[model samples]
Target: MDARLNYFGNQLGAKFLKYINSAGHALGLSSLPAATQELVKIRASQINGCGFCTDMHTKDAAHAGETQLRLNLVAAWREATVFTEAERAALELTEQGTRIADAAGGVSDAAWAAAAEHYDEEQLTALVSLIALINTYNRINVIVRQPAGDYVPGQYA
Candidate 1:
């Protein structure tokens, strides 16, 4: 399928993407675990139906040594036995955060408590920021109908 517009080539969109990508870089430096970061990114992309992002993040995850079993099970994390408790909490938080528009209330207290149990304040801060950043990328890519399956790991690095 063709995209509605060429977001990369457009001057305005390119400028916006550059800045947003910078925000992601800042979050990448946060205290959150890198494995959790990729899982959150990939999960959020799937929820948002942002194929381009899913492709990018999954490859990035694999390149960083993420096992295929865990990657394949992210979408079914509630039933999957692959993730740790900490990772599960973060994934739950990512789901509620990404689907905010579909629910009246935001993330559940139980979910927050679960996350708190696993992550320190600094890590929590990074997780929140990463969630927000991935959602932003998802929206942009979905709106522009960015094509998927051509991403190379660390292409943006």
Candidate 2:
């Protein structure tokens, strides 16, 4: 299916994307674990129902050697046993952060404390930024009706 607009091709969209992508690149260099980063991206994309992002991050994770079992279980991470405690905490934070409107109080202190137990200040900063960044990307893709399943790993790199 065709997208409503070629967001990456239009001049204004390209400029906006350049800035957004730079933030992603900075997050990539952060102290946050790479696996946790991918998992957070995948989970948030799933919550947002952005098929384009789900496809992109899952593919990117796989290309980086993420296990198929783990990738397949990301949506059901709460019930899954393959993730580390740190990863679980990050996922919980991602869910709360992504669904902020659903919870009147926003991300709970419990979620933040759990994440704090697993991550350093810098890592937590990256995780928070990553969540916000992925959500922004998700909204853009969903609004533009971006199609899924054709993304190659690192295509935007």
- Whole-model Cα lDDT of every candidate shown, in order: 0.92, 0.97
Residue 2 in candidate 2 has what lDDT?
A: 88
Residue 50 of model 1 has an lDDT of 97
Compare the candidates by TM-score and give the number of the best one: 2
Alpha carbon lDDT at 14, candidate 2:
98
Evaluate residue 81 in candidate 1 and report its C-alpha lDDT on the 0 to 100 scale: 91
Instruction: Report the C-alpha lDDT of model 2 over 2-92, residue by residue, as the tens digit.
Output: 8999998999999999999999999999999999999999999999999999999999999999999999999999899999999999999
- What's the TM for model 2? 0.99
Q: Residue-wise lDDT of candidate 1 within 48-83, one digit each (tens)? A: 999999999999999999999999999999999999
Off by over 4 Å in 1: none
Score every model by TM-score: 0.96, 0.99
**Worst-scoring 10-residue span by lDDT in model 2:** 148-157
Name the candidate that leads on lDDT. Answer: 2
Clashing pairs in 2: none
